[model samples]
Target: MLKRVIQQFQLDVLATSEVEDSHSSTVYKCTLSNGENVYLKIPFTKLKYQRELEAYEILKGKVSIPEMINYWSGDEECPGAFLLSELKGKPLTSAAKPTTAFQVGVLHAKMHSTQPPSEQVLNGMKNEFPNWSHFIDQQFYSFAEDAKYILDERLYQKAIEKFERMKQQLPLSDGPSFIHMDFRPANIIVDNEQVSGVIDFESVRFGSTEVDFSKLYRDFLSYDSSLYSAYQRGYNSIRPLIDLEKVLPFYRFTDAFNSIGWCKRRGNQEHALFLEENLARLKKWLL
Candidate 1:
């Protein structure tokens, strides 16, 4: 398969190594004989391949997507693959000035500015819910059933009750926009406090921009409240601030619930306990 990709691209490779342990794809770093390097992502699933391939096409000239070097796909049983130029920079998590939340917000604002086209994959999906509250309620119940064995009944019931009460507070929104659902520090690349690139478009979707803000808040804001102001300043510089402050608490609750579900299923005692501790933090808003 590697030989086919290199031959298809008519490129000479010096060596290749597995660089990213992707859940749905195998990512390889190919250093060519001439010292130029490129990444090869071979999908283990059709859906992931289709999404990543199409995502790159849609995001081609609009954003900081990697340049496609070569590609192949559409086999029922065989994995699809593509080659891309390597994005230069260190991951924001470990980079200097990593806490520069302003940069993060600016990048997201830039992405959200590009509305998803009507025929975009995520826009085509017909996911329905009566309202945001119904969605949150369903989230709790959907995982609540499975959580019974994973969590102490008393703790589980407390969470359900708390989130149910928050249901009334769920805010309404205008419509969906293109966003990185997994918009976190790890997926961002930073150079000298500026974002050099945003990677991982597999989970790209047209959804409430708040869904992503919630993720950012949960993953970063909780750790540093200073980021809230910096991020807002940067984001608003691109577009006027909406009611993000008013609605963020509700989304934070939802984010916590999602984390709880993931931790429960992971069955890691430490992670589960962390969520239990998280409950204490959430009480500030949920209660």
Candidate 2:
């Protein structure tokens, strides 16, 4: 089905679109007859495929995002939807920069400015996951028991307790906006020191604008203070100041829980370790 679709699209050479490490889908890169580069993503499930396609359509041309050219439904032979989009530059993870952090901050600010079609669409886009306590009790702790040896139970329990207490004292905001729930460095593309494009809209949902920045801060700024400062400068250039102290704990907790899930599914020891370390850090922050 993919081959036929590529042929129908008049593609010349199918570049390496082999599966990446994502647990979701099989992604491919194809070059068309006119030297146009395109990415084909086929998810493991029908729901995910539909969600990603909807997200791509919603996000197309709103910000610096790759253009979706076509979508193909799967028959018994294909078994999944096919997403075709123009291949853009490298992700920010590969193209490190002193300004990458700031670029992301600004990008996110712009993304939040675009209003979705309805409040329902906006609500659907928000991270629907519960707060840290529920996430730990239902998700992380269960996973830790399943992967006992890989996790630090004491630290996990401490972090969970801390999160529950901190959640009450944390500041609350009712100003909801479009959030790229997985706004991390790897999903951002850069060229000539500018963000050429943003990719991976699967996690695109409506929620607290801060939810989007959380992943960015955890993935990039936590490693380098200078980058965090630079990112703030860029972000503040567009929007006003954001209270990092209020948001950092939530961001760390979210990232830690996500990392734990990743390690459990993929059996990645490094990710598990990172999860533990982040959990400990969150605990200290809450304390």
Candidate 3:
């Protein structure tokens, strides 16, 4: 695969090492003969590949992201590949300080404030919907179908009822904005406490800005209220923060529910722990 990528992109590679933590794609850290370092990513699915390429093209100057150096649409023997300029620094971990979260918040605020160049660009992204509620409706019911068997009868019914109630009570989306659907510490690159770049554009989309916060809160912010407050402060420094308190519970619940359904569909024992975790989350939400 690396040899073919090198030939197709005409890259002079000196050495390459695989990134072990890349779950949805095969990523390689390639050091070129001329001393430039780049990432060669080949996504496992066509959807992810298309989203990443479109995101890079549309967000070239609007956001701080890895540069897309070159790309190849694969044939029968190979899959599509993207050669991206390396974003410096390590992935932000749980140990990162409140200041780092503030930086991430500022970066995220910039993304949320950016409007697509035109309706054509907005419609081109595969993940856009009419509004926040529409997206949630689609996701909740579809995931419910996948997770029906995973949850007991009482819990499943409670989830349905909760979604219906949430639909009536949730506020209208502020407006369509560019969002990193999977924004989290792992996708954020930081050097010496400053965010250098954000990576993993496969989930980029035009949608509700508030929904983007669900994953970050679930995996990071919930651990420390101080971090959350600092993040909100940073975001408000750029633009006013949304009424997050009103919508967070609903978004967080849906995010957890989606994870459970995704794990069940993957049908791997390796996902057992994740499945159990989301199941517990659902029960808590339903209660």
**Candidate 3 or 1, higher TM-score:** 3
Candidate 1 overall Cα lDDT vs. reference? 0.67
Off by over 4 Å in 3: 77-79, 119-129
Sorted by TM-score (best first), the order is: 3, 1, 2
Q: What is the lDDT of residue 256 in candidate 2?
A: 64
Clashes of each: 0, 7, 0
- Computed on alpha carbons, the lDDT of every model, listed in order, comes to 0.67, 0.63, 0.82
Candidate 3's residue-wise lDDT over 210-279, tens digit each? 7888988888788888788888988888778889989898888888888888887877386898888888
Q: What are the clashing pairs of model 2?
A: 17-28, 17-29, 125-205, 125-206, 126-205, 126-206, 126-207
Between candidates 2 and 3, which one is better according to lDDT? 3
Q: Estimate each model's TM-score.
A: 0.78, 0.78, 0.91
Per-residue lDDT for 1-287 in model 1, tens only? 66766676677888999865253477888998889889888776676777677667767776665788778873555567888998887666522342467877777787777665666555222223225345446666776765566556766677777766766665665345666667776677776676776777666655566667776666565576567777888788787656877777766766666666656775557475656755555555444
Kindly give the stretch of ten consecutive residues in candidate 1 with the minimal lDDT sum: 123-132
Q: Which candidate is the best by TM-score?
A: 3
Q: Residue 217 in candidate 2 has what lDDT?
A: 69
